[model samples]
Target: MYAIIGATGHIGNRVTDILLNKGEKVRVIGRDAARLQQYVNRGAVPAVGDLKDTAFLTTAFQGATAVFAMIPPSYTASTFRAYQDVVGISIATAILDVGVTHVVNLSSQGAELPRGTGPIVGLHDQEERLDVLRGVNVLHLRPTYFMENLLANVPVIHDYGYAGSAVRGDIKFAMIATADIAERVAAHLLARDFSGSSHEDLLGQRDLSLQEAFTIIGRRIGISDLVYRQIPYDEFEQALLGTGMSRDVCRLFVEMSEALNRGLFAVNRPRNAATTTPTSIEQFAEVFAEVYRGAQHRHAA
Candidate 1:
């Protein structure tokens, strides 16, 4: 049996679906029992509890062959790094205690760096903590910027008629669909081909500029004049702060964007066919249009 953390989330949900379809026994873990009910109905065993509780996680992870681990973001934490440490330690300790033979962790592209990568620094710490587990094979799946992140700009597009971010819209970087990440995770968990602690980079089909991505989205949504704008870092930070995000989180987000704009995300690691996934910006735009239209319809109602 495979235990999946954050099973109600985008990547975890897809992983659960793929595994269950193949007749694999899946135990879906999440904080909300209601969120996990659908997976329960779909043949997955629901294991609902707070991830920060080691006892809860240890019990949930017991009797599982492999566990899919990820630290869900806590944007409102008073100290984000400390929160990540607590959760990471809990997961690592539980995996060791349960003697789970394999683990697949959802990490990010810049997780190799020890510092200066903002929120990614937490993921780096998680990787280091998990590395200390004896006899457990861990695979850190480091995926690039998620295309779904662009959905955060939906309100900006609706209100200001443009998509905006602190990073330059002209800079090209890998943007992956969450479904692709799930597919790879399912493949790795099912195959169990990897042993020892290792990492893999999941870049999308190709590098794409934000302007190029927005153009595709615009065409799909039938908004001929829609554009992508590069917001100033201070303005972006303030905007996030106004949205009730913690000050540290706001600063970290801007720093991450700055790092992206400076080409820090892809530094030293060149993309190849193995890293490139199949999903394209054009294909993701169709999904974006559906969401956009749904939001529009809700507003109209």
Candidate 2:
């Protein structure tokens, strides 16, 4: 049996679906009862409880062979560090208590960086806690910036004929679709093999510049005027704050963008079969283009 924490989320949902399709007995853990029920209806054993609840995780982890673990997002916290510290401790301790044989942790690139590396520092701490486990085989799956992140910019691009971010418009960086991450993770889970504590750097396809990405989107969407604009970090923070995000959360995002600017998210590992995803940006756009078009339609409506 496989247990997936944060199962209602985007990547988590894809992982659950893939596992179920493979005829695996899957258990899903989620905070929302209604969302958990949706997974239950899909043939997964639904466990409704907060991931911070050790008793809950302990129960969910029981009878599970391997588990997919992810730290749930906490955007409203006054201090994301404090929340990460507390939640990281809870998750690590709970996973250890459950005695699962293998754990596939969803981690970010540059997580190996030590303290004072800003956003990567928090991920480093999570890995530190997981590293102490002697019995469980833990694999840290570090994926680059997700392509789904571009979906958020669709609104700005459609409405204003451009996409904006604090990132350098011309800086080429590695980016992967979330489904590709799910594929790599699901393959690792199904293999049921343990190589002790290891790290898998998932570099999806080649590096792409935001400016180049805009050109591709423009060609497909028939909007040659589409542009990718570089914004100031302070302006980005203010925009996030305006969205009701906590200052600390906004700061982490800004620092992460700075880290990206430093090329901290690039992968150096040799590409392998596992890292190869069949989907490309063109394919993704072809399928999900309606979402962007729908956004445009909604604005016109």
Name the lDDT of candidate 1: 0.92
Compose the digit string of candidate 2's lDDT tens values, residues 1-301. 9999888787999999999988889999888888778768778998888776788888988999889988877889898888888778878887788788799988887898875345667788888889888787899988877878777787777667888888888888777888888887888889966567888887777677888877787777778777889889999999889878999998888888887887766634456776555667776666447778888788899
- TM-score for all predictions? 0.98, 0.94
The list of candidate 2 runs beyond 4 A from truth reads 115-118, 267-274
Error of 1 at 248 (Å): 1.6
Angstrom error at residue 281, model 1: 0.4
**How much lDDT does candidate 2 score?**
0.81
Model 1, 100-202: lDDT tens digits are 9999999999999898889999999999988888999999999999999999988888888999999899998889999999999999999998899999999
Worst 10 residues of 1 by lDDT: 263-272
